[model samples]
Target chain A: MSWLLALPFFIPITTALIAFLARGRKHLCSVISITGCFAALCVSIAIVTLVVSGGPQAAQMGDWQAPYGITLIADRLSAVMLLISAIVGLCVALFAISDINENRVKLGFHCFFQLLLAGVSGSFVTGDLFNLYVWFEVMLIASFALLVLGGEKIQLDGGIKYVALNLVSTLLMLTSIGLLYGLTGTLNMAQLHISLAEVDNPVAISTLAVIFICAFGIKAAIFPLFFWLPASYHVPPVAVTAVFAGLLTKVGVYALIRTFTLIFPNDLGFTQNILLGAALLTMLTGVLGAAAQYEFRKILSFHIISQIGFLILGLALNSPLALAGTVFYMIHNIVAKTNLFLISGTAQRLAGSYELNEIGGLYKASPLLSTFFFIAAFSLAGFPPLSGFWAKLLLVKASLDQTAYFVTAVALITGALTLFSMSKIWAEAFWKPHPQGHCKSLYSLSVAERLQRLLPVSLLASITLILGFMPEPFIEYALGTAGELLHPDDYLEAVLTGSSH
Target chain B: MNSIILQTATRVLVALILVFSVYMLLRGHNYPGGGFIAGLIAASAFALFAMAWGMEAAQSALRIPPGNLAVSGVALAGLSGLMAIFYGDGPFSGQWLTLIGAKEEDGIVISNVLFFDIGVYLTVLGAVLTLIFALEEAS
Candidate 1:
């Protein structure tokens, strides 16, 4: 049973090895990757169940214990995150098999895709801060490769900026690990949790906290630090871009929550204020950035920045309820965001362009796509009855409870802006007529192309709806996970106690 | 492809990076550096040699693409974390051994974490070098 915890990271990696050695068989490589995704998903779920039934599991490499040995811990928070990452990774992998062209496949797309998943899953499950940084690099390296899969002028240009910025983040994070180790004596997350609380110089601790925030914040694509994402995310194949939209930056957000909640809980006073204000600005900037865009994928990329603010508000509030909302929002955002990207790709397939000016009257072209698009759009905009609604409801209620009037107002306003931005996409890309000139140039798809295109995305779309309707189980788990985070004594005990045991 | 002296130096430096990377990983637990810094240090060594020699010559000489080095490094590093599952330590627990004898009596038997560090070392060295090589070749 304990062997299952290793599967999520191991399966893809092994399959990746096999895929790489398949001697240029592109079809076999893709099939191997998709199979790895499903296996990882099942293992992720089993690990969560194991954590729930048998209690938290800690493993020390080579029989060497912690403080002396590097450790991996699968606590409630990490197991739940592993599950979420597996879902997103699996859905995107399946979607990519169909949406990715054969030309792109020859570009080592499967290799990059598998590496990205490995990096992401490693980040979710690792217990050491240093290991997490390596995982970050893993993901970033793969992302850079994927973003420029075709090596086009725009991709290379945009990928350069993305790579440089991320490299800086990695350098900063590595330095912070040095700082934390120099200051406190451990890179183990639980040990750091215990050690950081004992450090007396309030100022030094606060400075370290800010450094961590900057390091992770860049990855999350928060405001004032998010320009690189929209610049580069739009350059990749639609499937690759869509998955990055769903997963990459969210890892940053996850790091923020993990660090703030676990490593620096005692020093949240000034940092939380800064993060709170940044959240509002991020929300506005993202939606506004979306509004200013005429390209379909670019608009969604901008919105990613804005929606992250909602997730951050939960962490900034620093309460159980707010944390739960943050968790819920992260889940809802992944599903809805992936859905939008996939559907938008479908729109591109049928309509022939991502430029809104060139793509109009989606309602006239295909009713089914518009319906699915509407579901994802409304859910993203925080409309009631969907999962997005409940997440926002939790966040809003938490804000009001804390009497954070500024954020409360900002949340409602952001909701409006979100709705407005999504509608612009629907109207311009779906409702409005593709002016006579553009319509004449539309690309027609073969019947098989259409079916191959719709099946995987539709499966994901249905998952989004089902989760939205039955969010109770998920919500309860989120509340529990958030609770464990706020009260991380259990996590501390899991690591520290295991070392002594 | 030009001169024997320069080619010899590149080979020496690449070997040096590999050794230096290991030293850093083992020294990390108690000192200023650890697996990550050591890994990068080693990688940088390879990168410097790659810069000195052409990327193609380096890739072929290594007998495999550096990209695979990066990929395998990540997998090995992750497997290092999963090492704890076999023991009862939970997920990513630290496994350190303090070996006694020879010149350094208090020397620790480097655990698989060093292997993890080497993994990172290769990945960093390979990934950045591959990228730089690709960009350079493209131009």
Candidate 2:
């Protein structure tokens, strides 16, 4: 059971080593990376199955008991996150084969990519706060490398802003961890949950909660702290940006959810209002920012911020339904967002530019590619019978049930604005005549390059469609996860009492 | 750096520091000296060597790319943890074996922990050297 829990992260690290060793041979390295991601996906699926059948599972490292050594626990939430992230990792790896150049491959792109996956998986499964911090640093270092892999002037410029702001967040996190440990004398999350409840100092606890909000808020790019995201996300190769878009900020949201629900569930009155305001503002600012962008990836990057607002909105509502909404929305956003970035990459390939004014005629050149774009873009914009629609429906319903009419209004307005941005991209890039008078079609790409690019996009789009069509099981699973989160007795027992269900 | 006196002193100091690093690694399980500290000490010795004899001479002496060495070290560390699985324990559970003497208490007892430490040692050494070498070459 422990091996099953550990394999999702362990496989990626091992793959990273092999891929690094094989970096000189590009084909072998890519093959190793793709296989590694597939193996991780398979392991995560197994974990999800185990967690569903048996309940939460926990494993202690080095044979040490929990609250003493590192524990890896997989509840329904962790299992689902691991599964989705692994899927994203595999898709990005496949896309990278054609998207990445030879120079970057030799520079160990596959190594860092696998390491990032390992960090993300480790973050999802870790049952310790310090362990989560370690995983965050692992993720940060790998992402920084990936962000500036080519050392383009633009990449370097963006990487610095990304790193500089993130480092501040890291510092705040460390300080908060230190304060929490000094107050509670434990870094183990389950143990902290118990110990913190006994601490009578509400003021200090509230202060610590605010600190956590600021730290994680920066990472989540909520409202005022989101400038770094749009500045940096559009600078990388589309494959790198695609993976970052799918998994990175979502990890921040996952952390915020984990810490707030598991560790600070009793302090909701204090954090909820703050989160609600941030969520609404984040959605408004993000959609408005997207409305102002003409660059393809830049627009997508800003939309990531807006969608984060919705995820946070679900968290702020803090009902079982709202939390379920958060989970579903996250999964939907990761798929649709990643697929959109990938489609943008393919669009750039065909139209020869990411600037809306510089490229056009994609719909006429390749109707298949245009269809793929419509599915991903419209899904992102919350069209009916699509994944984003269900995700938005859940949140809107959650807000309405809470009688939070303001949040519901903001959410609906944001969704419409998001549609406006998507249509702007469609009209300029796909519908209009090509500025250069000739647009390269998907057929222009070699058979292998075309397969390497389109397969991931199509698979992701199908996933969106499937989720749209059959959200029942997934919604039920999410509600179950929300129930477990609201009452973390099983998680506590699994970690603290050294038991696995 | 070109001084004969300094180079002679470095030659002796390098060997001594390396020996001490290994000693630190071996004694780490029961003592404060551990793989991380020992690895830093070993890396410092090489950094000194690179300073005294230049990076080329240091590279020839190491005879392996630092990047490859670092990656292999990580693999070794991970494999050491996975070793517990063969014994039907958890992923990182320590597996012990008595290498010599009559009993586990009296003999030279070793465990997967030592291998894990050694892996950390190699990883830190290789990673630090890789950074230092790149910086030196760039400058």
What does candidate 2's lDDT look like per residue over B37-120, in tens digits? 999999999998888888898998789988777877788889899998788888888888778974545888778899999999
Q: Candidate 2, clashing residue pairs?
A: none
Per-residue CA lDDT of candidate 1, range A206-243, in tens? 88888888889889989888878998988887888878
The C-alpha TM-scores of every prediction are 0.85, 0.99
Per-residue error at A407 for model 2, in Å?
0.7
After the best TM-score superposition of candidate 2, give how far the Cα of residue A374 lies from its true spot, in angstroms. Answer: 0.7
Best by TM-score: 2
RMSD of 2: 1.1
The candidates' DockQ values read 0.20, 0.84
Report the C-alpha lDDT of model 1 over B46-132, residue by residue, as the tens digit. Answer: 566667787776566667577777778777777777776566654555665555553366564667667677677767766776777
Candidate 1: segments with Cα more than 4 A from true spot: A437-448, A499-501, B1-139
TM-score of chain B of each: 0.70, 0.95
Residue B133 local lDDT, model 1: 70
